[model samples]
Target: MSPALASALAAELTRRADEDRELMRQAETIPPPDHRRRIAQCHRDNAEALATIVRRHGWPTAALVGAPASTAALMILLHAPDPGFRRDGRDLIAQAVAEGHCPAIHLAYITDHCAVDEGQPQLYGTRIDPKTLRPYPIRQPRDVDERRREVGLGPLQEQLEALGIRV
Candidate 1:
């Protein structure tokens, strides 16, 4: 990634973090139904912003990291341009959630290990496991396995290992 792109990504992540914090703060005072609705809207806006950023950057491979469980799902719903993209993304997210990987930790692994442009962490391949229905870290194979273990993927690990992923 070029210096300019890296700087842009850093700025974007910082902005997103800030927005997430603000959303959480707002959620604290809202009623349950309203809070859920507001949170959903916040997620939609964030995903839309992310989609725009990715599109502006030419649709680089993006990994949705974090434990919200809904992050990846929402991302897919909001950003994927077609039904196929949405289906694929949703399947992967389901696998990840089933395998007990949180979005943030999974995101860290992808960002740290993948060949992402320094400025654009959101433009990366979406790696999802078919059986576990979870997103795997594209960058750190070892960490992915470790995470699988931490999440108690005994049977699932066997299946993935058979596929040569070692998780």
Candidate 2:
């Protein structure tokens, strides 16, 4: 990515984080039942928007870090098995990567809140290892990027190379 594009992406990420945090803060101040539903809806919306963007870019894989509901929706849309249906997370991620789609992982602040307030990481940074079919926590964007480079991208590149998909 060009420097300008990279800068713009960083700015957008920061803005998103801020917006999510603010929304969570507001949700917390509200009463029960409604608060939970509102938060869930917000997350769902965010996830759908992210998925739409990913699809528009013609990428195959996306990792949802923080938003569990959103990630679940994505999995459904992608025809991946539901997390409760004995499906493997890693395999799904790897498959998407192999298909040349850019999988996205979401890291939502609500996770941190859940961790501190509820004694657990809500739904942030959760990743499924396509190879192992296990859940792994992706602590940061760099972590996901690195893993994609090491496991997903590298193998896919090798396969493409074998098929003569090269620069």
Highest TM-score: give the candidate number: 1
Q: Give each model a TM-score.
A: 0.37, 0.33
Off by over 4 Å in 2: 1-14, 58-167
The candidate 2 region of ten consecutive residues with least summed lDDT is: 78-87
Q: How high a TM-score does candidate 1 get? A: 0.37
In model 1, which regions exceed 4 Å deviation?
Answer: 58-147, 150-167
CA lDDT, every prediction? 0.46, 0.40
Over the stretch 1-167, how does candidate 1's per-residue lDDT look in tens digits? 57567456545644664665676788768788988776667666756665565455422233332223234334334332344434444454445554554343344324322322232322222444466654443445445555545534434356555656643
Error of 1 at 70 (Å): 16
Candidate 2 local lDDT, residue 23 = 63
lDDT of 1: 0.46
